[model samples]
Target: MRTKFFIFIFTGIIFAGGLLLCSNIKTKEIQFEPRQEFSNEIKISKTFKVKPGYKLIVESDIADVSILSHQNDEVDVNFYASGSSKYLKDLKVDFEEGEGTLTIKVKRKREFKFFNFLSEWGIEKAELKILTPQNINAEVKTAGGDAHCEGLKGEISISCAGGDIKLKNHTGSARLSSAGGDIIANDINGELEAKSAGGDIIVRKLSGSIVAKSSGGDVKVELINAMGESEISTAGGDVIISAPSNLNAYVDLNATGGDIEIDFPLKLEKKNHDKLKGWIGDVKTGTKIKASSSGGDIEFRIRKGEI
Candidate 1:
């Protein structure tokens, strides 16, 4: 029994010494030739003579993209990736061209950390920049960056997981959705739809129909003309509407727990608890309007001569 015990202890010590020696051995550095970091700028300029009724789709993570209109008939694209050389080089961005569909995407890699202590040190990745053409239908999706587009005449759709969205001077139908940031749109001439989970929404110069819903912020809309209908709803902030003098549309305001105020061309009579039923002027047959909130105030202003 003593001999067996001695052997077991000796084996354990030998194994531990081997492990210690192996741990102390230096690991080969993953050498990157040139060692220089990658550029933060990615610029792309391309022109496409595409016919009408086409679509462009862009998908990215950690990038900000913008699209604008131009007088030329050709399409243009520009992009810049902001990251380390290894990270950027590892990304594979490719595009597919179709008769009416253009798809752009980035390939991502898996990164692993071996030590828990190293994992505790926060590391922030950089984003990219993308600029696309104008006058074309577009759909953009980003995971962790902001997106802005302006002066587009075709239909537009944008989805951001955790960044702000800004749109201006859009003449066609548009849909904007964000999961973690604010949404702002201005000078929109066509239909508009927007939703946010944790930020405010501001819209101005709306000409057609609009629908905005938020769960955690305010909603403000300034309407220049209402060709069809409009609706705005929120769960945690106020709702404000500013309509033009020529606005001749139906207005519906509802707030479950906030005050309802309406300023119209004609006088309004208090109908019920936090509710009012009145029209400033003759509304069109297809006009539909609604402003609702669950925990904030509601205000509607109708400019003079809006009848």
Candidate 2:
């Protein structure tokens, strides 16, 4: 009988220990729940009417801005605000329309609260999307997010302090600058000026003059047609150029601490391991293509079928 009693006591102790372990696990799970959850989000949108040939300006401090061209004559603007309840309430969007210009600005009201240190209050996010006619001039500025544009026939200018800038199928002149991100352009048909202080630059299918410079990243350009002067430089990365074999251009390549590679045939006016000055075809009719790198290699090559 005593042995049976001890056995029952042992079983009871085991069951109680298991239950206590499960209770502690549940408490830990509850403690971790707050850290895993993000604050609630709210979305807002607005549209504005804009005519062709009108100037469109977008200014935002922390949103990714995207501008796309359409055949429609009116412009549509969409804004998305995502954050805590207080953050959503503090967000504001303003629009102004003039005779020949439309402006959209995103602003956030300042607030000070002691409970803001709580982890439940997440970081805010703002996003803007603009659709305009195919012929409108655009100027977009963002302080902390990416900017993307496509299919516009007018001049497009973008400035970003902390995100990338991408331009595609732009037929008119374009000027872009990014202080903290990359710049990419494709299928551009006009004068191009692109600069980045902290990222790479990539250009493809360019048909006109291009001036691209990167203070801290690489540059890669593929010329579809050598129509005008091209200048590409990088302070801390490589420079690569691909052009047609029959391209008539005066080429100058310089690599300070790296190699210069030329895979195409050129009438060498001057040649060295780190620099080359030459012409691809007729010297007088040829355009000028200059590429320089301070800390990386420079390469010039002819496309496969072009040779």
Candidate 3:
């Protein structure tokens, strides 16, 4: 069901701007047209004093997007477009008054060309900036672009198709997913569930439960202090973690094709399998630490006297 939903979203994005897809352009037939306008910057600023109970949904195919929270209850959006004018005309920003949600989208025409056509269309990048309240339940989707968020206090869901994903200084339940892009997050204060398909994943300074998985990238996790359970997995990269010295929990480490190294104050009682067990110092630590890898080595290290 989830996969179906993702498929629908992807389809909607491909058809977003109401533009038709072009057939393959032969490289020999491609010509640089000086008459075709190629660059533009469009900015939009709007404010919404939303009521206490409502959800905000934002969708885009933007080159890049950043969403941050502020002290007030209003939202301001600034969007820029740099591309073929024929394509930019289809992009639109939608919003409503009263208690309705906000949806932002960019519609671009897909261009296909034969071999050597890549030389004609140079690199084009656009950036969109969004600012909203600190407490908002929102979902963001971007294709061929980066998505970033910070200082959020409610549920956040972000997905990217082919760019980096970043979350900074957020304090709420989050669901982050990406394909063909790196993910970097930090300063989380609630449950975090993140997945990546073909890039690196890094999370630091989390104080809540975490469920992180990656398919083709390295995974790095660092916790200054934690108060919840964690389950992290990776299939094709190294897994590294750093935890507090006075950590507490039932730790589990597994690696299919890698080495395992853990630094704890005390040794865990062996589990009789190809794994190690025991406690660092006191068995009353509050949380459990578990690290696993499939094709790399693992290391678990302790700070100092915390054992």
Candidate 4:
């Protein structure tokens, strides 16, 4: 028994010493095949016949989206893509059609291969264009691209995850949002809501009410004939608002780290370097105009040659 016990202890010590020595041994570094990229071009086209109350919903993984309207009561869609899928297969689309509703959803299933030398990795850029019936409600979104919509009537919402959003000749209730880019609207009416995460919000020739906010960029709004109780705020950029000379608005402006300036006649209630509350034309029957900035100036101006 003593002899057997001695042998077992000796074997255990030898095995531990071998493991300790093996821990210090040099090993080859892992190498991946020099960042190879694979890309493809894809084109998709679809058309749908619609009724009186139709709705269009489109979603893209990474694409530039554009929407336009036509006279006929049909919705046409076209998508063109030419780029890599960034280390995976191309995006898969699911189309769903229901009673007065059409949906196009794009999705990508991620896959990771360990010890893969031929993995594909690159950006995927795409363009989506849609021609729709007039006065159709629509909801459009992109994961990482720009968006442009023109002449779309009815309630509409457009968004981009990492690019700019532009609206031209849009009417009715509209909402625009961007995660990391600007929001620009021109020749719009009705109601609008614009938001940005890291870029400016610029609206021109707007004949409606607006609610705009930005996290890290400027806010500029130019109004036309009439406006609703509008509110514009920013976290770290300037705010510039312009309206017609005879417009009636109850103005309330504030800036935490900058100045406030208004180039209009007013029954000034309160005035300071960073705060102002007054009325532009009629105090009793005016829309509320509120703007605030935390780190930049706030300026209000009358329309050119109208004051």
- Residue 217 in model 4: lDDT: 99
TM agreement with the true structure for every prediction: 0.76, 0.83, 0.78, 0.81
For residues 182-277, could you state the per-residue lDDT of candidate 4 as single tens digits?
999999989999999999999999898999999999999998966668899999999998888888988899999999888899899999899999
Model 3, span 52-150: residue lDDT tens = 435667676555889888777778877776556654564566655535566666544454335433422432556778888877777889866899999
Relative to the true structure, candidate 2 reaches a TM of 0.83
Q: What overall lDDT goes with each candidate model?
A: 0.76, 0.85, 0.74, 0.84
Clashes of each: 4, 0, 19, 0
Candidate order by TM-score, decreasing, is: 2, 4, 3, 1
The reply for model 2, stretches above 4 Å from the true place, is: 1-38, 111-121, 305-307
Weakest 10 consecutive residues of candidate 1 by summed lDDT: 115-124
Best-to-worst ranking by lDDT: 2, 4, 1, 3
Which parts of model 4 have CA positions greater than 4 angstroms off? 1-39, 84-89, 111-124, 305-307
215-256: candidate 2 lDDT, tens digit per residue = 999999888887778899999999989888888999889999
lDDT of 1 by residue, 42-67 (tens): 44555566666578788975566766
Clashes of 3: 19
Residue 122, model 1: Cα distance from true site in angstroms? 9.6
